[model samples]
Target: MTKESLKELILTLEKIQLVLIQEGEQEWVYGISSIKRRLTDINIDSPDFKKEFKSVQLSYLNMTNGAGSFSDVMIWRSNVEDRIKVNKDFNALTKKTWELFEL
Candidate 1:
């Protein structure tokens, strides 16, 4: 997503957080704070960043290397259901964790 889009998502989440708090669901306040921090930390103007960002999405494959792993395959390799596989495979674990939270 673009910076503007990320900002919009963060704003929406912030509103949700307020509602949650008023409803005594303070557990989600930290989630909203985390989202705001993460969205603001991104550099959406860089071409390479945008390219990589789009690459590993659940709908796009990773093509920077010769190996073409489909987006669904990529997601399967990194999502919560595959946490054990990720932990056992050191090669993509770091990237997976980063992608899981960032993308």
Candidate 2:
């Protein structure tokens, strides 16, 4: 993928992280599957990154379908209240998730 799109995906992940922390509902962040789908293509040589990302993927799988319910987060996404701040900026999101992924 292009660098810009990758950044955008990472930023999306960051926003999801922000909402999960701020809103306390991890299942509401629907963009995770998008990021998970791209994991095989990231091409990062860091084993730690790979291991951590794989953990995320497995967690996502368990949360939605693997062992968890099929409750889709998109249904909740359409119901987000305006007062909740899920639309945080990319730089902050980037920085936050950077620390999270330990990249």
Candidate 3:
């Protein structure tokens, strides 16, 4: 991706991060899809960083287990710790992705 696109990508992630933080699991579906689509649109010069982002999206995909239906919310809410962990993982990767520019 161009440096401008990469900057936009990270900013998008940061925005999604806020959505995840402020809303319920159901609210995350839109942001998740947006971020994943954003990733696909990126064309990075470094293959390894590209691969890393692809791997990162895998973690995000895991969070979509039931797509936040009422039943899923019932189950997911019971395991608040996992939800928190999921948020933290995404946040960590989002932060880590900025290091790609150091190259």
Steric clash count of candidate 2: 0
Give the top-scoring candidate (TM-score).
1
Question: Which regions of candidate 2 are displaced past 4 Å?
Answer: 26-71, 74-103
**Model 1: ten consecutive residues of lowest lDDT:** 56-65
The residue-by-residue lDDT of candidate 3 on 2-89, one tens digit each, is: 7676666566566655555556544655655566566656566666766766665555545544655311332233578977776575
Candidate 2: C-alpha lDDT = 0.50
List the candidates' TM-scores in order.
Answer: 0.41, 0.36, 0.35
Where model 3 places Cα greater than 4 Å from the true spot, the runs are: 22-47, 69-103
Q: Relative to the unseen true structure, what is the C-alpha lDDT of residue 96 in candidate 1, on a scale of 0 to 100? A: 47
The positional error of residue 9 in candidate 1, measured at the CA in angstroms, is 1.0
- Measured with C-alpha atoms, the lDDT of residue 89 in candidate 1 is 48
What is residue 94's positional error in candidate 1, in angstroms?
Answer: 28
Candidate 2 collision pairs: none
Q: List the residue pairs that clash in candidate 1.
A: none
- Distance from true location, Cα of 76 in model 3, Å: 16
| Highest lDDT scorer | 3
Higher-scoring candidate on lDDT, 1 or 3: 3
Considering lDDT, where higher is better, how would the candidates rank from best to worst? 3, 2, 1
Error of 2 at 87 (Å): 12
